[model samples]
Target: MTDMIERSNTPVRRRSPGDPPTVPNHPVGPGRLRVPLLMFGAVAVLVWIGIWIGNTQLTHDAFFPSRPGIAGGTWFEGWQRWDAYWYRTIVREGYVSYPGVQSSVAYWPSYPLLVRSVSWAFPSIFITGSMVTLACGAGAAVALRRWVGEFLPRSAAITTLALFLVYPFGYYLYGAVYADALFVAATIGAFLLVERDRPGWAGVVGIVATAARPAGMVVAVALLLRVIERRNLARAACSPDAAAPGPFARFDPRALRRRDTPVLLAFAGVGAWSTYLWVRFGDPLLFATVEENWGQGAGPATWFKVRVFEELRDKPLAAGTIGHVVQGLLLIGALALVPRIIRRFGWAYGLFTLGVVGLALVGTKDFQSGGRYLIGAFPCFAALAEPLVSRPPLRAVLLMLSLVALFAMAVAYGRGTYLA
Candidate 1:
């Protein structure tokens, strides 16, 4: 009995430095990615089908419609809801400012510009936009799998990918005419590039990411943290007896090389936009000004307007109240995982998650679109998936809940409900 007990406690084998890395317990090569990609594709199709069914079978609420150039009488038109209307407006009539009022300038330019570029060949901005989103979503999934696979086992990586795809607002990744997919793709791509020691390429991708959304500047900051972390790791390696640097350790200026300068390019997209806005509208920060018109801005009043408690008190079971509650819960849960994320992935990922969640919370009223915004903080999903990889029953319950929420949100979005 003693011999058997000792044998059962043996450690798993570890690969030597010279050997090619293998998926933990799997011994597979690059082909391990194939199954995850296929799973992502399958989920995308299911989300698309759910949207189509909801749009065709249910009655849509009265809401703003897409502009003339992109509107059409087709199933695809169902996707041209909510913010897609604003994007179509920008595509048809370039960003125009209306004093102290909501305007096209409030929407970022990268997504609409991509849609217009694609429309040159497709002739339908709606279809072009959806195609762009789907392509970006695919890119995001691939990068996410690769990034997680770098540290965790194959099972953990796949679990992270699955949770991200089925996340409540994840249906937006399935060809919704929104910038979320593109922003996610570029952000994850940049992180993956940074992980691979290609900071210059990461900055290039950062340009697209920053231009895609207001919260994109966080990518630049995250990259900076990663660079600093890498530098500290190198220093520690060279001095075996020296104490390892903490995540927030101070760095030497001399350590920064020419290769690090390109990280500055991460700010180029937003810089160019600011320059354009200054020249065209006479206010470089017109986007922030425009955001105020949409009932979003920083201050105590904005926090009060979140109305989470008020909604629950007034109508706890109402759909709007329920949505707000779920959004609040998700925001709290993501923030709660920040420490774990930082501990597991290092300072870059932990702080990136914090920045994303902070931006989502700071200027919003009622946490509108909070869940959707959390999609950019992909590390939270990784933090959640890592432990679950060893617990099948708990994983199943979480995935099931996520699937139900994903479908519910997709259907509501397709039916033209004002879901963020």
Candidate 2:
């Protein structure tokens, strides 16, 4: 446990033979990248589907819609839910018109600001946000190619990026007037910066990301670690046998440690954000105010809005016990198994999964469709694909399918259809 925590906080250097690198309990550069390709392909198909369906849903009257203001849920219309409400509200009233809890616009200046800016130059939120995310998604793919050179080639990286762009979550998220699309791009871009050891730039990217979603705090934590490693580097630089003091003896072989700036920033971001939440809600760890507003302060975001009125509100958990811990726990289990699944995907990929799911576990476990909250962590796929799929041909196939799914999911999202 200590090792895991320390590993997470440390800024590790890119693998070098002399540096003695390690992968997820296995040899580095094992199988060729294949499985990731197919997964991405499937994702792509879903996205395309969402695009078609979402466009159609916009015109139908089967559902009523609310408008989301810049601050949160200040602009509630009768009957309609989240995504539709966001688009309508942003277009109709600008930032100040959000409804109830959803208005925590302070946490998301980037998306809202972008939408408003684009609205001035474009016709609709639908076009601007989608185009922005898609383009960012493409850039993320290119960055991913360079970042994952440890386990994948240019092709594998590109496939993973394409799949992430149209992921099922992107379909609904893109259509809705939210920051997810840009968030994905910023997060991935920051990770790529970390991979290159550009800590300051990475920090800025992380800051923008956090503003988009509280989960983005992970980037800040990773940055802090980088700051630490840079500051204490000299101590680590001490000669292996300088003094031979104790366990951390002046000269021991283990006295020195390599650094990765991004990992540290990710750690710091979470700490800072958590502290902020505490300050805002009079609690050290309160999440987005939106949950608190809906009275699901201690419930899952999904039906918790209803459940709080039915159960926990009067139970021991009371009004401030929010946490959709089940799925989050599952996401944790999946992350723990990540190293077992892939080679040396390391912090760039491994931690992305942990951070993404951890962020969702802490805050996103709410009134959202499956996979929506986790979409911003698109960087996780870039990292995870290396281990799950090997072999260029096989990885390509998987990515093709993931992209297809992305496309398909997009269509389904438009129609407000469900996937079995």
Candidate 3:
């Protein structure tokens, strides 16, 4: 009985420096990139099916229709909808405020800027944009694998990546017009840099991330946590005694200066962009404030608006509200896993996920895009994946359900029925 308990409680071992990496507990050679790439291909197939269904079955009356210039109208127009159309407009016309319409100022400039430059050489801006997202999304998967492997074994790391690919709302990444794929790539790369103990590079990558989306600013919490953890580790190592160290041993002024500078620089990158927004639009936070036009605002009031009797009493039980409810529950579940992430990963990763989710929840009218927003909180995926690593049957069921929901969401999004 004692031996069985001990065996059951034993932790899985990771590959040593000399040992070759494996895939899903099998010897698959040192280069384990093929499975993840294959995973991406599978997701692409699902997305294509969803888009095809929408293009054939749905009416375009209320849909944000794409113009005939792209590929001479051979391509399906279902992929261009909601915020995607705004990105296209911004790329072509630049930011301009229109009466009653959401301000183009609300959209960050980085993605549209990239789209404009890439369009110079490509046949179609939409095609070029899709290529950009695919490339960045692939990079993000690679970086995410490395980060997850730091704590989990290679097999678990792969599972986590798989989970991310099939995550119910992951279809957003496939939308070429959405900047989320690039944002994810930069954000994951920044985290990977911190894991490698390269603070300066982390901050450099984090700057690009910060420009990708407003939620990018929350990464500052992760950087700060990394700085404090590193300082603590340095002080503990330098101490003469293991148990009780002197005051001098508890703090290191030199290490603080060396490590904390990069974090400040990263934050300054975000500040510089905000300053640019202020100069151009007269409101540094117009990006945030513009959410009001969409009925979103800061604090609990935004969420409470949906609950008021007079507000939603006449509102029908439509597809949009249902999608929001589904996504909100998913986001809450992910948020609830932060404590487990802290225990399994570390302070920086867990706190980063927590801070990002909390910030996203605030000033949001309804949870319409909560899933896509939470997709930026990558650690939540890791935390959710950890327990299912060894539970093949359970993981399989979860993946099946996720894939089903992904299909539904993809169809809805393509049909313009679920704009969020």
- The top-ranked prediction according to lDDT is 1
RMSD, model 3, all Cα superposed? 6.5
lDDT tens digits, residues 137-183, model 2? 44444444444553455554555555455443455333344566566
TM-score on alpha carbons, each prediction? 0.89, 0.60, 0.84
Count of backbone clashes, every candidate in sequence: 1, 125, 2
Better candidate number, 2 or 3, judged by TM-score:
3
For model 3, the stretches where C-alpha displacement exceeds 4 angstroms are: 1-32, 65-69, 72-76, 98-101, 234-260, 303-316
Clashes of 2: 125
Residue-wise C-alpha lDDT for candidate 3, range 242-302, written one tens digit per residue: 4322323323345566555786556765687789878877778878877777777565678
Query: Which of the predicted structures, 1 or 3, would earn the higher lDDT when compared with the native?
Result: 1
True-vs-predicted CA distance for residue 344, candidate 1, Å: 0.5
How well does candidate 2 score on lDDT at residue 127?
55
Clash pairs, candidate 3, are 297-363, 298-363
The models' CA-based lDDT, in order, is 0.80, 0.47, 0.70
lDDT of 2 at 218: 62
Instruction: Please give the lDDT score for candidate 1.
Output: 0.80
In order of TM-score, best first, we have 1, 3, 2
Residue 7, model 3: Cα distance from true site in angstroms: 28
